[model samples]
Target: MAVAATPSAPIFVVADDHPMVRDALALSLGAAFPGAQVEFAGSLGETLMAVERRPDADLVILDLDMPGMNGMAGLAQLRSSHASVPVAIVSAARSPALMRQAVEMGAAGFIPKFTPSQEITDAIRDILAGAVWLPEVARDHQLAPVEADLALRAAQLTPQQHRVLALMAQGKPNKVIAFEMQITEPTVKSHVTEILRRLGVQSRTQAVIVAQKLGMEPPAAKGS
Candidate 1:
């Protein structure tokens, strides 16, 4: 019988826009992997940078609602760019169907935000061991078929397109998105066109509705 091999310098990354969440994940992972190197990224861009900086990373756990990710689009980008590195979704959304979709889309696992720290550490270990980590009962948790369909549609978008869609979901005007993204209005318009086309919706409201159903929502104002 062959023994399992653990990473000699495992680099586990926890990507989330929320600072506290990132810190918590880091603490749990640090304890679980002991000598493992853990990195923290706040957005998809940072996550990609982390990937570039730590090519030897063994696993990446990301929040689906993080900035610039546009949901599962970030997951697809990571998998496509770094096929050798395993990725997982750690988000507030807790739908079994979404978890299934993420695994189907190439994620090593789906870890919901509510998961206890101990369980999360265990999940990270299992994924590092080359096993799929999922809630035992989520395998049977029923979801509307539309959720899975939307998730697949979401996977088809480019990373930039996903960011555009995210801004639209926040009800940000094109000018605002342009200013925030530092792109020309025309470029933003182009992204919107593709976002609408890929989402199979004619307008932004409808597009936002689709994402909301998938548990994608803009966090309330800082003090709200």
Candidate 2:
């Protein structure tokens, strides 16, 4: 396999809610890139803020089910806000479908949480060297056309529109969305309208279904 040029002492941001997972990733990253700096975040909001603070971060390893992630929507949000930074999804859910979806949504890599430490380090190395990494099991898995189309439509949403869509998926009404987003009710309604139009869905319920399609509902057997 071809490897991109590697950066020495690269900065990495590891975002996962579980302290143990964060520490394990930190250990792997620190060992792999000696003198590297590793930052931690327990939620999507924090991850975005952390990345915003360090736009030059070489890589970001994110947890899909973390607080404020709203599934792949958070990935879309991060990609939209900081398209330059390479973000990898490191999660317990290892379904090939979810892995393909993450890549479809622009992840640099999808590392299953149970990955061995040395392999994790190697994957991070590959990602830093400008390669897209995925578990061996996901290599030959093809994304369904409908799944790919959903990813494409989801990617079309502006970051704010993504936030509105996430709230709508949670069954939040426009008034509540307005209060949470600190915007006027009419603004929220406008966002909802745009979300519906962008997703090619006519009604809020249909939009919610689209959101759920991009949501974090991995199989019950796939523990998050």
Give me the candidate number with maximum TM-score.
2
* Residue pairs with backbone overlap in model 1: none
Candidate 1 wrong stretches, greater than 4 Å:
1-9, 17-20, 43-45, 64-83, 95-105, 136-141, 221-224
lDDT to native, each model: 0.77, 0.79
For 118-197, candidate 2 gives per-residue lDDT tens digits of 98889988988889999876664465667667766776777678778878877788998899889999999888888888
TM-score of 2: 0.79
Tens-digit per-residue lDDT, 155-197, candidate 1: 6777677667777877899999999879999999999888888
Least accurate stretch of 10 residues (summed lDDT) in model 2? Answer: 215-224
lDDT of 2 at 107: 88
Winning candidate number (lDDT): 2
Enumerate residue pairs that collide in model 2: none
